[model samples]
Target chain A: MGTVSTVLSPPALRTGMALAGAGFRRWATYRQAMLAGAFTNTVFGFLRTSVMLAVAAGAGGVAAGYRGPQLATYVWVGQGLLAVVQLWGWTELSDRVRTGDVQSDLLRPVHPVLSYLAADLGRAAFALCSRFVLPMVVGLIAFDLYLPHRPATYPLFLLSMLFATVVSFGVRYLVNLTAFWLLDIRGVIMAWLLCSNALTGMYFPIAFLPGWAQAVLWYATPFPSILQAPVDVVVERGTAGHQATVLAVQGCWAAVMLAAAVVVQRRAERRLVVQGG
Target chain B: MADRPTTAAAYRALLGAQLRAQTQYRFSFALDTAASALITLLDVVSVLVLFRVTPALAGFSFTDSLLIAGLANAAFQLCDMCVGNIDTMREYIRTGRFDAVLLRPLRVLPQLVFGDFSPRRIGRAAQALVVLVVALSLADVTWTPARTVLVVIAPLSGAVIFGAVFVAGSTTAFWFVESGEFANAFTYGGRDFTIYPVGIYPGWFRAVFAYSLGFAFVAYFPGLALLGRPDPLGTPGFLPWCSPLVAVLAATAAALVWRVGVRHYRSTGS
Candidate 1:
């Protein structure tokens, strides 16, 4: 206990780094799953890019303010980012809660949230290298995938991706926390899957929605901070200030959701009733 | 395998037990159903969003694509409701469940695919049906009696084809335990591919997903028949009416693959 360090302290940072490395190693073993996921993403990439190109053909080479290159970048890179941000079902936390394995998580010196975040970051790093690159390679041969115009946009996009990962973790942790009171979290997870895919632009750009709908999604929900904002960052969607503002919004959502998670965990601690020995 | 009546009764019994267990959490079930419906409805909205940017996709009008999308959606969801759990073959194998299943006096395919139902999928299927009904009403089809029969036959045929895809794809799990995403690329990815006119895709893509696989028969060809139009990609005149034949062939292939898979199953000796 004397050696234990608070969040961001040296020892805690070391622990987080180790956890992240472990996470990276853990997922790296799933070689076939990686190949399968990449194949699926690339297939869907062709489906999406083809349709968007058709739309471009119909609109005389520009549709919804995106040219062919922009559409290619959006569809392909966004498909890669799908696994990076993990915009769908993940139930490990809730499973731990149900099985009472979370008690072991609590007994650790490092905080559960911090550890999980670190591990997820590791997972994202692995995905960014493997799953993320595969679709880009496939898309490059087939379509005009876009690259950032300014050198500065690259680092900004990286920061946005990091923020997106944090925001996703925060939102998912809160969703998982619902298991504290619910008999089953499957509905919650399904509902999350359905809405997040739509709102986060997994199916199509939130930008392609009616302007009012886009604004509502952009401002009112943290969903876009997960996938849409990061992609927008890379595509150089607007002026530098607009990109900065998008990054800022992502940062804000990440902070807000994480704060909410901390608060919820505090509350759940009060109702701590382990289910099984 | 059990007697026909007994197998049918077993399916009913298993499905009933599953429904009871799921409905025991009434609130979650309702929430999930609504979410499921809304999720699928968003797929329709996604197409509308595409049309908002363009008047036509590869010469198919908004309503024409809608029929294609709706038909594919309805068929995929029906198959998803029935055979979707074939994606869980890895788990059944890994847990020694396949071994137990083999010992049972029940037909493997029905026990595996048809013995469970998730009510949430009903919401998705129902929403797709609504889309199909809407697309049918809105599309500029000249309603011949033959076309009318196509309306009834097409979706059922498409569903059979998709179910076959699910079975065929998941049979790979017999070799690769973690083949979920591989199977999903065809079952789910095929749904996305079929929703638009085949002309929108590139030549190689069309050759692979549409001609090589049976996805074209799911919606594009049937859609052509419904609209009384030729394929924009120059599919033959007789192709539109070939969905039934395609469905039978796909089903036959799937049955063979599943048989070989079951024969090769060496379950976890847990």
Candidate 2:
């Protein structure tokens, strides 16, 4: 029993490491997309920020607890944060599976769930450098958005954002795994995109939303924690205790989703075996 | 001479082939259509949610915004259906499929137009029509002969503008066949641009749409005419009429550029 346990532990760790390594290599080849993504985000950020400023002005200097600089900070940072969090265009795993690439993945020694997590993490890391940091820096210099000047706040904000990354990736992976059942994923993705756009505080802040709607969105989806919470931490001078609690909740959700992925994968593998795939 | 059987017959042949090809994947084709309709419906729902929270967006009333959304969706989908193959030009060239297309006896543009037809995009068209019907019932659009004329031309002119953008994007494949990213600014970005009122954007962005890209025709200026909206930026009365002209210019520019790109493509064979 002891020898069996010892052998399994090493293989699990090795599988994780291999997944991460393979993920990083694949991401490295798509450097051009990373750069182009950054540029497109920058354009969109500017356009969105302009509209937000106008809306804020029309609302008589503060709509939903945000003055000019505060609103600018929200709009600009939300763009950057969303880049890292990526609430849009995350249809990778489902597409691969639908194209029958899941068969190749099943052949791997590592678990399929770990492989997806690793690839997402690797891609998120690349996106952070190319889309988030660079664009935020440009917005900082060009638009003078209010940024985290306090040292402690930055670290906490980073932690929340990292939590956001993990949770968002988990939700996306869970959604992708559904492709095992649903052949057409476009409807599902579109629904996610619309929901995330509204709830992630991308187009408008959650604070601006009605109380009932805000309460529902906060509990139903991980959207707020993924983008708004991290940016709000920066804007509110890191009074992020509640946000931290939310992140902790997000972590729990990620665990639940990961477990779900394992169950689904096992069932799917059995089905594949029966079907002679 | 202009109504020659060859031209009309060629168009029919191309469309027929496209229809037959789309019928090949029966299940996938149905799902694609259903999925697209659901997506557009979902987006409309989001807009409806926004309207619930605020009575208006950017001073436009609920019905007004709905009208713009409906009209824009119709215009975008119609043009998208017409020139949808442009987006796949790079793939065609990269896979050496363009060679087979070139070997065909029909005019290159006609064959290209006929080669790829997405029946599923009817999903978007159907959604747009639904929105238009709903918005018409909701909004009090007192129709005049002139207003009716403007409404009909609005979508036709919008199609021209979007088709021009499609042509421009396809032409770029001759130079940067593998790099389809830059083309997004013109196609996807342009569609988003048209969905919103011109007043929502800043002067520079507006200028790019008005003067540089000439994309204002697709929805904005024509929308003002349909909605009887005042010039948000204080433009002349004739400016609204500039939509049809701008569309023609954009289409002309795209054609000229495409000719040059095709010449380069034939010479370099890349």
lDDT of each: 0.86, 0.70
Q: For candidate 1, what is the recovered fraction of reference interface contacts? A: 0.77
What is the DockQ of the complex in model 2? 0.28
DockQ, structure candidate 1: 0.78
Tens-digit per-residue lDDT, A126-195, candidate 2? 6666668877887787675775666677777777777788777766776676677665565566556666
Candidate 1 on B135-193: residue-level lDDT in tens? 99999999999999998899889999999998888878789877648778888889889
Native contact recovery (fnat) for each candidate is 0.77, 0.12
Clashes per model (N, Cα, C within 3 A): 0, 0
Off by over 4 Å in 1: A1-5, B1-6
Q: Best TM-score goes to which candidate?
A: 1
Candidate 2 per-residue C-alpha lDDT over B44-110 given as tens digits, one digit per residue, 9 for 90 to 100: 5545654544555567777877777666777788887778677788777667777777776666776
Interface RMSD for each predicted structure: 1.1, 4.0
